[model samples]
Target chain A: MVLEATNNVLRLDANFVDYTLVAIYFVFVIGIGLLARRQVSTSLDFFLSGRSLPAWVTGLAFISANLGAVEIMGMSANGAQIGMATMHYYWIGAIPAMLFLGVVMMPFYYGSKVRSVPEFMRRRFGTGAHLVNALSFALAQLLIAGVNLYLLATIVNVLLGWPLWVSLIAAAAVVVTYTALGGLSAAIYNEVLQFFVIVAALLPLTLVGLHRVGGIDGLVDKVNNGPVENMLSSWPGQNLTGFESPAASVIGIVLGLGFVLSFGYWTTNFVEVQRAMASNSMSAARRAPIIGSFPKMFIPFIIIIPGIIASVLAPEILALNEGKGDGNIQYNDALLILIRDLLPNGMLGVAIAGLMAAFMAGMAANISAFNTVFSYDLWQQYVKKDRPDGYYTRVGRIATIAATIIAIFTALLASGYSNLMDYLQTLFGFFNAPLFATFILGMFWKRMTATAGWAGLASGTIAAIGVAVLSQDALGPLSVGAIDLKGQGASFVAAGAAFFVDIVVSVIVTMFTQPRVESELKGLVYSLTPKEDRTDPNEKNLPWYQRPVLLAGISLVMVIILNIVFH
Target chain B: MADTDKQAAKEKRAIRAFDIRTIIGALLGIYGVILVLMGIFASDSDLKGGDGSSTNLFTGIVLLVVSAFFLTWVRLRPLLVPEGDDDAADAHIE
Candidate 1:
């Protein structure tokens, strides 16, 4: 990371009370781990919360698991760089896909009782697709986990002024002990706690920042009259998309981010799918992502608005980002600058705790998911089969420790990025976009053979990486400048390329190969599975408001309204 | 069969004793109390060129209200462990 030597790096500027609040928060996190330890006995409990969490709990955990580096630092960075156009990430990019996961995808995931998303792939397309998915998914989790761990320790380094390694080790120890002790239950419990704590921490920063910028009207007036054009509007997003033409910008965001990237991420990423899988019943499982969608659509207000406020209040932020000023505060520091300027000590402590909670929760989610796939999909399926249930649980704990150790090194790789989201999006485009393509194609089209499944996954991943490498400034210095797309334009184009390649390859491969018999495709494929099989019988008696379809419909409408209003 | 049921019941009893909502409620209550106290006692001289709005006090009250809701919900619908293998527990909404 480039040290902004002229300016302090996210200094809490704390006193006695601020440290006290953060310490108390840590104690509560450890306490929750101890409470959850009693619930774990079998590997199932350790990995999947024994599939016994309530919808409300799982729903909150679904969103909270996501509220890590991306939601805070990444979105705020987008908010600073692109202004109102950043809302695309939430309203169009996330909400619809999340609802799709709830109403369309969760039945296949939960009803079949697969332990992980890759396990479902195994059942559908045999071991070839399963192996490809498991290896890629495991690798993706570790790299992403490293990102979360690095950011968490970065906050600790700034707040306490500790050496980077010392902060890294301390942060890792807290997450690993809790995750190892109680496993998924512990992580889920802490995630719910972290959710509330993070909200408490951020809500005040937003309101206070808004107050400083005068109000909503004042913010609009200032932005409308500010230095840049197209910052106030979310549509076309010319500034964000790096397109001179409005048409190209709109198409890029909708097809690249909205259709391909969003669907790929929300539907197939096991880190998210695992949260819904932990729900006790089919109905609760389906409802998890939908319940999450309610808060998911509205989070940009709390997260991005603060960044907009920071950019206005601190003119040096933009000046430094554009290399016009001698000072060195990047756009990634937008939220930190707000915290420093707007908040007093009591709330400052809360804000610091919130940033830690966000990073920790994100790392814990990744570590927990990594351990599960490592133990079940990689270890048990491949290395040591027929092990006793208790033996696998032990392996999971060991895997948690091993993942933490590996993540310490991986964290170093992430330090190179000025804006963390750029790195994160490139990773997601490589891993998730192709995986989503293979998953959706196989799930809907029964003729998609096992050979096609693995082939599409491999080829699509290569294509995404290939496109990203060609784009300007996407892979940092590794980019070749063959492509003119800038910033997240490379990510969007890469995701689109991955999706297209996966589909075309799968179709061509399927024509030359044999598919499984219709009888074998029952719950895994769309057309072959009966409608009744998708829903739990108990869901019949659920209230209208609580029904999955009704909830998803409501969520879809609300997100559409938000998009139009913001547009 | 009887022995298995007895074991399941005992395990369920242990689980019920450590209700997750209770932990969340208690922690939120602690943070809320601390913040409320600080909001009352902390001098306002620190805020830059102050408007008198108490961000700490308001945030504390909201946390307390949310904490109360969680505690109340848990009291109304406590966890029930069904008489079956752990794989097939009855799904109940909290």
Candidate 2:
């Protein structure tokens, strides 16, 4: 039955027209990248686009840089399995954190004029904390880039029957060519272009799927009649409620993902923050994330809705091992299956191109972030001091190439991990959960000594890892009744546990240690910063409706309404 | 005279918005029309894939409109070369 079910899923073979469409996409993207090269004249331009991007460009790239291969593939798969519950990652998890970054944290990040997040850590905490962050972030970015490359290669292999190595090398070559030549400017520009391609490709797929599933009403009816319970609900509750797991309690979701993971990634991660930092003005920097939140609010309709439709229409294909026994579902195949079964020849080509765009954009974003951090925070600071400007630029390009090679090897290593998305999130828990705790204390509490910062980070990471290891079912010491909190639940619990550990350790250490001098703490801590330094001057000039705060408020309200309606 | 010309060229290059409009506009316009045509002459097999709907036509039209917007935006407010010191500290870091 399993074999037959797998065979039933449609396999698309691209015609000349489809190939032509993909070729054109490549031409335009590379052309844009090469054109952007003309803008790169300095190390700053190579790494930071000379800090001259307008709000619109940076804003779009800010979100697009994150809409990588994993997000589109993994979220859609989660949507199929979890129903409306998956929307929590966007609404409850992402929006508020983004607004927080724009409103509160941007003043510190952009105001401090730090080249990267680790640089901020160095200034606030000390070099010990900085090295810990820079090394971890650089390694994590490389691992993620490899994961994306592997995922894209797998898709191309499955669809076109091309050899995996061929696909991997081709993708690496294109990304390296554009990224090494154009730097961040090229990456950002391509990110914006990829955003459009993704929307153009996926939006049509959603519409077509909805039409096939008999629109929203039809979808609701089908899901209501399907095997999955509460497929349409977004709120937590009893058996049929959303977030069906006992471990996925409302508090767990709020604290684990919403506060810890979201803030860690959105506020501190250089991959995302670089976009906002490249904005031409302080006001634009503040506005970038807010502008991104608008499009972000509506993304689930395109990515998630198709997954829901698939659950009702094609459950056999989504089932693990083709719906055999108690195996895990092939959740990664969710988006690929939708494209193959839904889109016709010409449109099929366009959609595949969009998928390719997603893969490359994701890889480029990570590589760009990796190169910047390595060159600025690690290399320039430690390896070579007082280097010429052109020297660093050359170093940056070399780093891009070296990182891509490392990423290719990493992608090969990641093949052992069956579920890419779950592995990615678990990795985030190991690093980001503890990091967020340290940042909160450093930013808000002026008394947080550098010793406290380093201690907090170390203890927090150890606690998170310890919890993750113990929670595994093989260990079984921490499992409740039928609920294996060590599985998917481990990430959530570990994050919350790490947060507490960091706070306790940080506070206790601070009391016994001497704080940094007030002179060194200026503009770095919240309480010590002046009013003019904290507030955006453009706020008074812009009308209330056009203000960043107001726009964020509107977005928050919309999310609340969506939760209620879906509930 | 040569120095002045060189300086002007530098200023223009610095001020220009990354020059992506023509590329995006041309691609969208071209593909948008093709999809529009495909939608019009689509066979019954094509319709089956879309669940008996003309999504291609609708999507094509939307793309065309978006392409037009990009073209119009470039025409109305061309990107300018940014002026001022490129490396000035805009924020108070100390």
Candidate 3:
């Protein structure tokens, strides 16, 4: 049944005109990268754009890099299946994360002048923490890169009638070549162009799609009348997949996402930190987050709303649609379905461009970050310590190519995985959540000694991995009910468990361990609150935690009002 | 450092002024506040959920007020040019 439906839908024919245009766009992106090659003479330039990016450019590029093909489908699929609650991840989860990051952590990061998040980890903790962070981050990058490639290939295959591997190779080649040629500068420049194209295509389609589905009012009615409506409205109902129960969702929304996720990703993630590293000044870096937060406020209206409308637009397919046995929608096909059925002639080409833009941007960012880690953190730190800057630049470009090849193969494997968002969250649970806990403790807690940092990381990792392994039936045949909630419950589990374990371990270890030397603490603490160094060098200071506190409060009020009302 | 060096630094301040980037950023914050307001008032008529009642009005008012804080701050903050080389900024406390 699924195959037949796929066969019927996959009959989309891309002629010479469509292929020619896509090919031209690909060439243009590559050309831009090659043109930017002159700017990328040193390793620093290649990896961090020579720190010349202004506020708007960095802000736009930051959002564009994260809004790739995988995120698009994952968000849309969530909106389609889960109802309005999917909106919480962005409104309640991501927005607060961005603001707190801007207010609390940016000063430290911008002030310290660290090349990467893991490099900062090294200065604070030790070589050991740096290596573990570098490795785990690399692994997370691999997963995201692979999924991004799969999304690109899947979209092209479904929409253009190309073979999956053919689409994968073609798409990967263009991004890899450009990224290898120009590095971070090329990636940022291309992201700006791609961001425009993505917004142009998506905004129109969202409006038209909503209009076709009876506008926002009609969409609300259809969803409210649908089977998934109740699940979609509030979280952790029968159809609710993530965020545990309503109580947990409320608390998690308030505490976890409001504080932890915002601070963690914005402040510590290598990819995000890399963006800020390219800023022209501390002020530019500060503006990056504030400017970046603006796009996210409007994105859900275009991205997720279309999914809700899609459910109404194609009620026939959704209702009678026999998805995979596990209940995963062929989510990669959702946007393609919308494009083929709804859009007019020229617009189809535009939507195709938009999807390609998203795919390429994501793939390029992942490969670039992966290469950066391999070159700077791992290679420079451990392998060959004294290479020339130009040589490392060349090697970083080579790592770009290598990372793409690895992702291409892994993407093929990921084809068997179900749903983009769920897969992303599950992977984050095992990897990113632990990293988050360790980074937060490492930053905010003054008495959080090295032993505390390592213990927090170790406990978080073991607990998360244990849950993941146990959920996977690794401990023998469990009752169906025992593992039934693993799909949606895993993220909340990992997030809560990692936080608690890291806190416990950090506190317990800190009791017996000494704080970091005063000199060592100077970089992080002084950076956070500039006045601290002058006020009293010996007195441990917490930066105006009040700013993040205020910002977080504002963010919460915004999310509550937006989600309950607009979403 | 001599008086000459200080004089040189003072003369090199290249038009310390707010520009298009600042305006654009500040405007974007205003737009975010507008969106929150739209969400609140429109919620009653909006399909998503929530009763169109006094509670929503109250929630909406509170959110608009909070968003106003960000909006006002973005507009009010002074533009500060970098004090040295871009790469030097990276070595601020290193």
In model 2, which runs have C-alpha deviations exceeding 4 angstroms? A1-10, A237-248, A318-329, A416-425, A473-484, A543-546, B1-17, B20-23, B45-53, B88-94
TM-score of each: 0.94, 0.92, 0.78
lDDT values for all models = 0.82, 0.78, 0.64
Chain A TM-score from candidate 3 = 0.88
Can you write out model 1's per-residue Cα lDDT over A1-567, one digit (the tens) per residue? 333322355666788888888898899888878877887756777899878888888999998998997578878877877788999988878888999899988998887778899998998898998987888888878887887888777767766687778888999999998999989989988888888888888887888777877888888887777665667789989878888889999999999989999999989888888999999888999999999999888888989888887777777666754557554566777888787777777777788888898899999999999999999999989999876577888999999999999988887766655456356546655878888888888889999999999899888988998898888988777789997887777788999999999999999999999998888889898998888777888788999877999999999988889888888
Top TM-score: which candidate number?
Answer: 1
**Top of the candidates by DockQ:** 1
Q: Candidate 3 at B87: error in angstroms?
A: 2.6
Error of 3 at A100 (Å): 1.0
Model 2 lDDT tens row, A73-156 = 878877887778788888878888888888878888877778888989999999998998999999888888998888777667
Output the better candidate (1/3) by DockQ.
1
Candidate 2 local lDDT, residue A547: 71
- Model 3 misplacement above 4 A: A1-8, A11-21, A231-245, A252-263, A320-332, A416-428, A469-484, A526-529, A532-560, B1-94
CA displacement after TM-score superposition, residue A317 of candidate 2 (Å): 3.5
